[model samples]
Target: MRFVSKLTMALVGALALFGVGFATVTPADAASGTIHFSIVKGGFFVGAEGGNGVLEFRGRRYPLSIGGISGGLVFGASQTNFSGRVTNIRRASDVAGTYGAAGAGAAVGAGVRVITLRNEKGAILRLQGQQVGLMANLDLSGLVISMRR
Candidate 1:
């Protein structure tokens, strides 16, 4: 039993060190891109955009604005512009799935559905506008939506 406990402790320590290293990893290596998205009046918005920034996701730095949205609720027709270092990229589909699930789990999560619908609409608008190269979807959590150009 003592041996087992020691082994477990070692493993836990190693994991903790790995986590620290992962957190410090930078998210910018190449010239960052742009990211543009709108946040519905009521929902969580989280994302980043800029000429260069650091995005730590899944223990990797994948050139921000490369992925898409994560998850959350979206609504209405709104536009938010931000110019900065592309920090992270999360796929819209992924975010939708996560948020949808969470919203469903919560008793008052129906609001998520409405927000997500708005997000879809906003995404469509962004796509139709032909703003792809420097853009990405976000969850609107810690997102700072601002206009640049």
Candidate 2:
């Protein structure tokens, strides 16, 4: 009886140690890239925006297309140019996903804007730049991005 109990305790300890070691293992670090894009938006109650951009990653440049729509209290029109860093992407294609934002802001003539958005694939975009013309909005917006073939 004593020998059986000792063996059982030893087995349990070994399994716990193995489990902890496995749990402590970490995943590979994700890569990041730089991007620049410009979008023009306008509407009354509903708004639409589209533009094109380039992603510089791993010593290469990839062309990207951007489009989105917003619904709610949206009024006016404006053009915004954004330049920023995209992180948590393994490759250029990972940057092609749907990113959504819900907020309210207005721009008259010239204004500066900063925003952070994330996608389903765990890619995050930290963007900030200048907005020109005139625009105002309070709505939910979803932006879709795709690689130019």
Best by lDDT: 2
lDDT of 2 by residue, 14-110 (tens): 9787774433322365789999999998999899999999999999999999999999988899899999999988779989999999979999899
The predictions' CA RMSDs to the true structure, in order, are 14.6, 5.9
* Local error of candidate 2 at residue 14 (angstroms): 14
Q: What is the C-alpha lDDT of each candidate?
A: 0.31, 0.91
Error of 1 at 5 (Å): 4.6
lDDT of 2 at 140: 98
Q: Name the weakest run of 10 consecutive residues (lDDT summed) in model 1.
A: 121-130
lDDT tens digits, residues 4-37, model 1? Answer: 9999889878988777443332344212233333
